[model samples]
Target: MTAFEATRAWAEAQDAADPLRAFRDEFHIPAHAGADTLYFCGNSLGLQPKGVRAAIEAELSDWAELAVEAHFRGRLPWMHYHEYVRDAMAEVVGARPHEVVAMNSLGANLHLMMVSFYRPTAERSAILMEAGAFPTDRYALESQVRFHGFDPSRDLIELQPDGPGGTLSMTAIERAIAEHGHRVALILLPGVQYRTGQVFDLEAIVRLGHAQGCVVGFDLAHAVGNLPLALHDAGPDFAVWCTYKYLNAGPGAVAGAFVHERHARADLPRFAGWWGHDKSTRFQMGPHFSPTPGADGWQLSNPPILALAPLRASLNVFTRSGMARLVEKSRRLTAYLDWLIRTRLDDTLDIVTPDDPTQRGAQLSIRVRAGRDAGRSLFEHLERHGVIGDWREPDVIRLSPVPLYNRYADCFGAVEAIEAWVR
Candidate 1:
């Protein structure tokens, strides 16, 4: 057999040996002709669980039969729909239910969090973020600083990479904190950076920020369901993440926010909408703005149950698997990917993410050496060959092997594809 045929046979044999191979049946894997597509884009849009279709259809039925009454009378009443998700979301982030709430989209939620936490005094008005954070986050921080009358060009402190195409150094991070911590109102970072896949030490950052009186928050768009997170223990003033990525929720699903319990009754300033009102008196609807107790107080509008439905379906599986066991699987799966890449693809590729599993999730960033079109070229190559991965601008390709649905053989196949492409 040719190398490609041998590779295919190897994939089959490994799949046959996989313990989690059955979980693939839980998803409707995309197919063309008789073969399944090799899907690694779960870092961007996770494949739908077979159960999600039915969960969503059930909502549609309730909508058809009950109409607006679905708000209060459906099987899962819309009036308290967000409640159904509260505990599960809390579990995903390791927070108490009261400290967590499903709200707007990721960017919108970040802005809401900013309004409540990014209180800049003239003396400490700068915002600190890693250079090359997700564009949305950079835009969010810029607008936030400018809105508060600070000049982003100077006040938005971006910690650039320490050397030529190298990662950010912990020493540099701490030095910046020590030098500018007093002049910074907030420190914003991704729990797992989108481009480089670098995982920040949230607790260490938070502890340091608090010592310097700087509020810390995370754009967990990449970290939420990918790794083990204890948002409460991390003690960030706030955090926001979307559900579409690792949670297997549908595209544009509602996002979640973690507001530490200390913020629960602190009279923190917020930009509120009707949904943030006290549930007990929400129907009372007189002329007064009474707030819900915790993270719910940060909400601005009613949730989209259509969006919530898939998240619910995904969370049910997570609840069953338990975060601890799933994280164990994630570590091994990503470790195997790292091992394969280092062992096979390193000569032609630069692995940009951190070397430590404790410093990343499932996504591995590959910097192809074939020039500016490398990201796009490699992306198309993978797709045409039936391997899927996400690409960032310039020359970075990201592959994530998700815990719930990814198999050990999938890891090996992806690495083989990368090696084949490079050679």
Candidate 2:
């Protein structure tokens, strides 16, 4: 039978047997023409968990009734609200409770991390990263270098792919480190690349950077909820991530930061704020800046409770689902998508995501080979046909089937839509 003819039956069978099938009901899937859209854009913005509304409403009710007393008397208690999700967030990122803190947005947290970790001297002043990192990371690294009185052009070392439609290789990365190891003060890279969906070897990079006397960190925006990370054991100097994508937190949700325990007590310099001050005596309005120990010390301001409640709701699902199980399903689902795209649409699409499952996450970035406008045309057609995937400028379509809410059937529907569109 043709690819289109067998696709639905196979997908339905897979969905029927999937262990994580129940998770699809936990999220609020968007509808188009009275049917659930094949929502596969979890790498960009996650579908809201059904529990989010009630979670936020509870906070709203507490505020309406308790007013200023909410700080002490609310159900979650505003003063310690950020602490409620600490362990859950830590569990998601494989960090020790003391080493992780849910805090400001991704960019702000990255800047804050640089204040403590990106120290540069005249002798060792270069920062290294893979070329085509997410734009914000590029900006943060460049600004941090410039802020330290170094020229970005000279101090920034970006490792580029050796061939067209390829990703940075570990050999190239290590070679760059060996070449500029002494001058590279900070080595910041993504846990999973934004456009190509390449999962870097964080542990290896950490070991290599430390051996070269460079501080290492990760912008884990794509990796946190999508991959299994052992941040504490992997031993990066620090890491930062946003919760909105795979975490199922709403748009502009509170982000998180991880600082290794080795630096927790170091007399490192940081940009401090009232909330980062010792919580026990914060209400006393002390003139001195005494930071809370561990990653909490990096927090700059009190977090917004409404923004955090959804993260709590999403984390509850993760606590139940377990990372190993989610990752197992993620691998299988992504592999299936890869297989379908190759067998059914290989003539029109090229998968830029790493072919090795171990080197990628849930996303598949497809480069449209049909024509210049073909990628956008197909992406829009998929949307019109109730398949939701995101488009990257020029010629790529990004689709991530989150194990938490996406099903084998959703994957089938997305490819079917693409097939229909191409025809």
Q: How does each model score on TM-score? A: 0.94, 0.97
Residue pairs that clash (backbone atoms under 3 angstroms), model 1 = none
Task: Write model 2 residue lDDT over 1-423, tens digit each, in one string.
Answer: 213333678888888888889988999989999999888999999999999999999999999999989989998899999999999899989999999999889999999999998889999999998888889999989999988899999999989887436678888988999999999999999999888888899999999999999999999999999999999999999999999999999999999999999988888899999999888899899899998889999988888999999999999999999999999999988888888899888898999898899999999999889765888888889888988889876677899989998888888778888889887
Task: Write one digit per residue (lDDT tens) for candidate 1, span 1-423.
Answer: 212222456556655755555667888778744777777888899999889988888889999999999998999998888888889989989999999998789999999999989999889899999988889999999999999998998899999888434577777888899999989999998898788888888999998888999999999998988888999988998999999998888889888899999989888888877899888888787777778889999887888888888888888888877888778777777777777777777667778888788888988888877665765777787887778887788678888888777776777777776667776
lDDT of each: 0.84, 0.90
Find the candidate with the highest lDDT and give its number.
2
lDDT of 2: 0.90
Highest-scoring model, TM-score:
2
Candidate 2 error regions (>4 Å): 1-6
